[model samples]
Target: MDWIEANFTDQAGLAALLLAALGPDGDDGSHDRSHLLRVWQNATSIAGREADCDRAVLTAAVILHDCVAVEKDSPLRSQASRLAASRARAILAGLGWEAPRIDAAAHAIEAHSFSAGIAAETLEARILQDADRLDAIGAIGIARCFYVAGRMGSGLYDPADPPAGRRDLDDRRFALDHFGAKLFRVAGNFQTEAGQALADARTRTMRRFVQALLDEIEGKSE
Candidate 1:
């Protein structure tokens, strides 16, 4: 218990420091501060029952997960995990965190991304992964898609033009294509039951939204 307290104390302090460093731009209403908070909340909810999970590690990873996002020129396209890991290590060390715990937390943070290609390796990582994926689905996911798409100067949907094969698809592609390409694929990647359920449910909602958009384009929906 004492060990948990000590390790977790350091983890919490480091997380707070990173959050402070991140400041306002990290709250741009697109997977920003509040979104991180929600991911923390969601991770806690699912991870609480798993005895093998470390609450402190999971919490810290969730909060500092996107710290490097602000540093990137284009977060959606750039792989910021390496930068995030570097920043996370420094932040943890500044808070007096030992090598092992800091290393674990940093690894978890780096592995939490869906685009980063480094899959979840631990139960704690899995929880963080699910929580982050949840944010990329459902209502919040929809909002974030547009927010990011707008940031990247993408269109909402292209009625007349079809997906111009794989070679031409870039950031300029519509927000709707993201669902077909990635968002809809999240459910299959989730490692936990809670994540799977949320992904399944969110995928349905997204499908409905996509179908409705098509209906509207075809003069079917009101």
Candidate 2:
């Protein structure tokens, strides 16, 4: 029997496969093991409420979603999902997955990207999209935004127009501008009811944080 079959009865097999696919070191902290686990939890929770979703496919998709590392602002950023999908197929196939199951997982991975903007064609795909996108919002999302910005050498905000006034929204130059460019828009266009509900709460958290900053700038705290 192949390694997949040998380990078929063991639950840890899935985790082992996903870990290998994620690369030896697991990740570089940004889209690391913790991120994948969070996405997995989110996907499974959404799957519980969604009808007609294949839990196995959704689980595999969540684990393999970020298998390949790509720069956040690379010209190929949007293609990361497509690349990951392609990689997922090979890994699933190696693990003795049937063609249809592999296809379902690959489809979910392909359609989960925000930049790719691909429409999901299956319930599993929709849930995966919603699950992954959820990670990009709320308190954790806010931390990630500044983390990436700092990595890219961006300023906190434009000093001349700190509250995003009188300046074009440019996330590449100012970390604060990302709220207008992307973060603030996630809640309004979710694919599932659960995703939307959670996103709304997270969106509010983000807005409150931004408002506090604005209030401080305007001396409203006094």
lDDT of each: 0.75, 0.83
Error of 2 at 71 (Å): 0.6
Best by lDDT: 2
User: Clashing residue pairs in candidate 1, if any?
Assistant: none
- lDDT tens per residue, model 2, 1-222: 544446645434676667776676543566888888888878777777877876667778888988878888889898999999999999988877889989999999999998998999998898989888888888888888898898789998887887777778999999889989998887688889988888899899999988888778667964
Please provide, for model 1 over 24-77, each residue's C-alpha lDDT reduced to its tens digit, 9 standing for 90 to 100.
Answer: 754357867788778877887788668898777787678878777652236453
- Candidate 2 has what TM-score? 0.91
Candidate 1, residue 132: Cα displacement in angstroms equals 0.7
TM-score of each: 0.85, 0.91
Each prediction's Cα RMSD? 3.3, 2.8
List candidate 2 stretches off by more than 4 Å.
1-13
Whole-model lDDT, model 1: 0.75
Error of 1 at 115 (Å): 2.1
Q: Candidate 2 — which pairs collide?
A: none
